[model samples]
Target: MAKADNIFNIRGRLGDFIFCQRNGKTYVKRYSGGFTKAATQNHPNIKVGQERFAQVSRYVKSLKQQLQPYLWRQKDGTFHNQLMATFLQIAKNETEKTFNELIHELDSYSSLSNKSLNKNSKIDPSTLLYDAKTNKLNLGIIPYELAVKYKGLFLEVATGWYGVNDGEIFLTESNRQYVKLDGQTKNEDQLVDFAPADDLDGQLPFVGLAVVYTDDATSESPHPVHTVMACFVETRNG
Candidate 1:
């Protein structure tokens, strides 16, 4: 007997058309008519052919409804369920804390006067001095997350050095580039500042505080590079 064709090539149509393969021979069953078996006697391995048919039938049943319109535009219910499941999993692992709770412990320290320099002082004297100079005091430590959420309030208080433009809060051109204020190009430095404008709402312009650091050197050389911290001292606008 001649060898049969592979069963993989047999295709099925929608509605009531049935397709099957035995050995290498193809067969079909139509809804309106009787079944038609292959003429060739070349039979495929019965076990493998039955398994292949079952697998294909399972795949076809799993497919979406054929007559549906714009399949891609429709929300996949299965996919949405999967996404929600993943979100719940993430929420379970995360720690939930209120902004006030996170920074409340630092409130006492943040309100202290910057003068009378003492280890027991609740606040840094320099910060108090700056507040006095600017006529503004650090209310408290803003939770990092809350600060980001209410960034508009902070931006209102910031100087023009920071502002939201084109959907991002960025430093102005004057402060855009990192400066080696301490004269160490190899080290890193950044400056940011912000203060409220004259408007009654007290919106702040973006300002950056400058950061300065020295690079680690291979030799134990005393590179006494220090950025003048005084530059950060707040000044009242005329």
Candidate 2:
């Protein structure tokens, strides 16, 4: 089956059809059908493609599982599917690209990049500072525009390791800190820290951030109206 151009402006496999985009146009195509198992196995190229697809799928699944805490609140189900497709394309077209190089490429990419944490959030992630030595993330003063409306803020920091070759990922540590948007807390800087073991070998380290705002400070299941999340640093890549 041929790749689709995402005519529906969607991605992933829907039943037998797969949706995708190429250039600026969107198209849809059947990803599966009209192929016997024995016939497919007879073609070496098809077998190789199938193996590659399976490997990509496994790697992407592990990646998504590791990032679930940051992305579970996301409503869009297609995010990971699109992400898988992007990784497949990279694997097929750029075999020489290292995982670090791929990370760098994704840093500048649109549509599937981690840069778009939350569109509704007033806070700009670029404005937040990361201190390498102290392992502290400083979320500078929340602006007056956001401070007046939402009184509760949640900050999360997570660090992990990813093995590109094996598609294995480990969540080393996570820190969750809360702040009340009152006169004292909102006026001062907020900080969160993460400390993971230094013994993780043969894997790249990644640190991620999540910031959410809610109206009820004490609500156990506060519905976050504004959410911000991103992986700011990959120690190996940086």
Task: Evaluate all candidate structures by whole-model CA lDDT and list the values in order.
Answer: 0.28, 0.51
Candidate 1 lDDT by residue in tens digits, 155-226: 111223222233332333322222222222222222233243343122222221212232211111121111
The numbered model that scores best in lDDT is 2
C-alpha positional error of residue 223 in candidate 1 after TM-score superposition, expressed in Å? 17
In the order shown, the candidates' Cα RMSDs to the true structure are 23.2, 13.0
lDDT tens digits, residue span 1-238, model 2: 4644333577666887877766765567877666678987879778667767777777677767766654455444455676676777767666565443554443323233233333443345544555556755555654333446654554444454434343334544344455555554455666666454465344433444444553322222233424444443423112
For TM-score, the strongest prediction is 2
lDDT of 1: 0.28
Backbone atom clashes (below 3 Å) for every candidate: 33, 8
Q: For candidate 2, which ten residues in a row score worst on lDDT?
A: 214-223
Candidate 1 is scored at a TM of 0.19
